[model samples]
Target chain A: ELKVEQNPLFLSMQEGKNYTIYCNYSTTSDRLYWYRQDPGKSLESLFVLLSNGAVKQEGRLMASLDTKARLSTLHITAAVHDLSATYFCAVDPYNAGNMLTFGGGTRLMVKP
Target chain B: SAVISQKPSRDICQRGTSLTIQCQVDSQVTMMFWYRQQPGQSLTLIATANQGSEATYESGFVIDKFPISRPNLTFSTLTVSNMSPEDSSIYLCSVGRTDTQYFGPGTRLTVL
Candidate 1:
């Protein structure tokens, strides 16, 4: 079974705090994606890391992929209440066609 | 990124009944997918809907429980049969074109 595991399933932070969510996969994959979903809402694309050392950043959110380590990270800087949501990391195994296998997700709660 | 939309943002249904959720994309896409997100859980791929062809379901999902239809390149429907409270979740539609996937707003289903 191909499994994607994420650390810190739940996190609470104060404004201006920083944290990093880690995603580790059991299989070899070259493409990883980060997504955010609010309560009762659908997913919003965050970042797509396609290769080792691939890093993408938008605003205060940054995502990086280390294929050799079979890991990816989503780093939050200067957290805000608006960033409070569930974050998921999806891994696409090199041979899994275009389907995505998602992790259990990390729930983030940013407080002022 | 394609704009995807799902009908019936939220609904309350009784058990033993069925509900059909519609997904529409702003532009024609090569592939459409359906996913389910249980409470506080990550998104799980239900199946991949291909235009003019039968859907390919995941390992745990079956066509009888979740029937999918893709009439064209930009529209699809997923029907949940004999609903139960265990089937309560948010159903999302995603569009895949040019190697990227974008999600719809989702349909929240509450089976009682």
Candidate 2:
């Protein structure tokens, strides 16, 4: 079974601060995805990291994948209050045909 | 990216009752997935709904508890049977497009 683990499950940071969420998988996989979900809303796609060393950035959030190490990272640079939400990283196991195993998720709280 | 929609955005039901959630995509998709997210938790794959075939459920889930129907490529439905307070969660449907998957708005089910 493929397992995905994320660190700092609960993050509390002030606005303008920076933080990074790490996603580590137990199996070898090349496709990783990051999603954000509000308290009562569904998930919103954040980034899709497909290859080793692949990196994507949107606004103050940056996500990168290291397939060789079976790890991915979502870095938040100069966060804002609106960035406070639960972040999840999902891994698609090899030949799984898009079946995703998601991490525990990191709940971010950005205080103004 | 495929646009998806779910009916009955949120509902409150009594224990032992059943609820059917509908998922529709704007375009035909080969792979549609059902996921459940408990409060303050990450998303868990419930099953894979493929057109013209029986749904593939993940471990810890069964067709008797959550029956899924894929009548066509653009539509699917999930019926939660014998609901209980433990079943209260957000149910989301997603479709695979190209290399990425898009999620629906989600249906929140609250069992009393």
Candidate 3:
């Protein structure tokens, strides 16, 4: 079974601070996805990392993948109040087809 | 990215009743997926919906309990049968094209 783990499940950070959320998978995966969900809302696609060194950034967030280590990272640069949301990482194993195994998620509270 | 929408954005249901959530995509997709998210948790893929075929469910989920219908390329539905308090959750559907995936807004089900 493929397992995805994310640390610092609950994060309380102030605006202007930076932090990195880690996503580590137990098995090799073909692709990784990052999503953000606001309270009582649905998930919004953040980034897609497909290659060993794939890195994607949007606004104030950046995500990178290291396939050899079976790890991925989502870094928040100078977070803002609007960045307060729960972040999740999902992985598709080699033969998973269209199925996704999601991480535990990191809930971020960006305070002013 | 595809524009996906889900019906009944939210509902409060009585236990034992069945609720069918609808998912519609703006464009045709080969595979659509159903996912469940408990309060304050990450997503767990429930099944894979494919047009003109039986939906493939994940372990710990059964076809009878969570029946899925994929009658066409741009639409699918997932029915939760005999709901319980434990079944209270947010259900989302997604579609994938090549390597990118898009998600619906989600349906929040509160079973009492």
Candidate 4:
């Protein structure tokens, strides 16, 4: 069975602080995606890490994947209150149909 | 990149009523996925719909309960039949092109 686990399910940090959310998957997969969802809203795509050692950054957020270790990290730099939302990491297991197993999201609240 | 949209951003329905959610993608896609996010929980994929094939439902989902129709390459519909309070959730639709998937805004349902 494939499972994705995320730590620090609820996070509260001050603006300008740096933090990282870790996602660990039980199976090997090359496609890992990160999404952000605000309250009562749908998901917004943030990153799509497709290979080992693949790192992508956009503005204040950066995401990296390590296929060998079956882990991914989402790093937030200079966190702002506007960045407060739930972050979810999903891995598409190398199944024949390519189904995704999602991690329990990490809800971050950035303080002013 | 694919731009996805869902109809009836939100609805409040009574128990035993059924609701249909429509998903539209800006471009043709090979596979469309439907997911449900319950309150305070992660997402669970309901099914995968292909243009000319019967939808493949996940473990806990069935065709009779959540019937899906893929009329074309860029459009699909998911109906929550005989809904109860437990069916109240955010229903999201995604289109997979290549390896990455793009999600629609989602339909928020409130079953009373």
Candidate 5:
């Protein structure tokens, strides 16, 4: 079974601060994804890291994947109030037909 | 990215009743997925719905309890049978394209 784990399940940071959420998987997989979910809302796609050393950034959020280490990271730079939400990292196991195993999620609270 | 929509954005249902959530995509997709997110929890893959085949369920899930239908490539339905308080959660449908999976708005089911 593929297990995905995330750190700092709950984070409280002031606006303009920076933080990083870590995601680690038990198995070897190159396809990883980052998603954000607001309260009572569905997930919003953040980034798709397909291979080792692949990094994707949008706005103040950047995501990177290290396949060899079975790890991924979502970096928040200069966070804002709007960045306060639950972030999730998912991993698609090899030949899993795109089925994703998600992490425990990191709930971020950005105080203004 | 694929545009997806789900019906009955949120509902409060009585125990033992069944609710069928519909998922529609703007374009055809080979694989569609159903996920469940309980309150204050992370996402869990319920099943994988593929066009022209029986839906593949994940561990701890069964087709009899959560029946899925993938009539075509652009649409699918997930029926929650014999609902209970434990089954109250946010159900989301997703479609994979390239390296990313786009999700629907989600259906919040509250069983009492």
Candidate 6:
């Protein structure tokens, strides 16, 4: 069975602080994706890590994948209140099908 | 990335009722997926709606409970039958193209 686990299901951070969310999958995957969901809003596509050692950055957020280790990370640098939301990491194990298995989201709250 | 529009942005319904959510894509896509996000929980994939065929449901999800239809490559619908409070959630529609999935603004359902 394929399982995805995320650490620190709930996070509270002060403004300008840095934190990282970790995602570990039980099986090898072809690609990994990161998404952000605001309160009562739809999900926003964050990063698509397609290969091992792939790294992507947008604004203060960065995502990386280590396919060999079956792990992915979403790093927040200099967090702001607007960046507070639930982040989810999803894995697409089969390269043929686009079905994504998502991890339990990490809810982050950034305070000023 | 394809722009997906989901109808009935939100709806409040009584118990034992049913609701059908529609998703329309701006471009043709072979794979359209439906997902459900419960309050404070991660997303669970309901099914993969393929054009010209029946939807493929995931484990713990049945075709009867969440019936889906895809008459073409750019449109699909998911109907939740006999809904209860337990069915209250955000129903999201997504399309996969070139190995990346883009989401639509979800339909928020509240079963009273």
Q: Which residue pairs in candidate 1 collide? A: none
TM-score (all chains, Cα) for each model: 0.95, 0.97, 0.97, 0.95, 0.96, 0.97
Q: Supply candidate 1's per-residue lDDT for A50.
A: 77
Candidate 2, residues B22-107: lDDT per residue as tens digits? 99999888889999989878889999998999999999999999999999999999999999999999999998777777899999
- lDDT per residue for candidate 1 within B1-112, as digits (tens), equals 7888889888999999999999999988767889998877888999999998899999999999999999988899999999999999999988755545678999999999
For model 5 chain B, the run of ten residues with the poorest summed lDDT: B94-103
Span of 10 residues, lowest total lDDT, candidate 4 chain A: A92-101
Query: Where does candidate 6 clash, by residue pair?
Result: none
Give per-residue CA lDDT, model 1, range A2-111, as digits (tens): 99999889999999999999999998888898989887777888888777899999999999999999999999999999999999999877533357889999999999
Two-chain DockQ for each candidate model: 0.60, 0.68, 0.67, 0.57, 0.71, 0.71
Interface-residue RMSD per candidate?
2.0, 1.5, 1.7, 2.1, 1.6, 1.3
Docking class of 1: medium
Docking class of 6: medium
Off-target runs (Cα >4 Å) in candidate 1 are A94-97
Stretches of candidate 6 exceeding 4 Å from the true structure: none
Candidate scoring better on lDDT of 3 and 5:
5
Runs of candidate 3 with Cα error greater than 4 angstroms are A95-97
Candidate 4 ranges with C-alpha deviation above 4 Å? A95-98
Q: Model 1: chain B TM-score vs. truth?
A: 0.97
Cα lDDT listed for each candidate: 0.89, 0.92, 0.92, 0.91, 0.92, 0.92
- Chain B vs. true chain B: TM-score per candidate: 0.97, 0.98, 0.98, 0.97, 0.98, 0.97
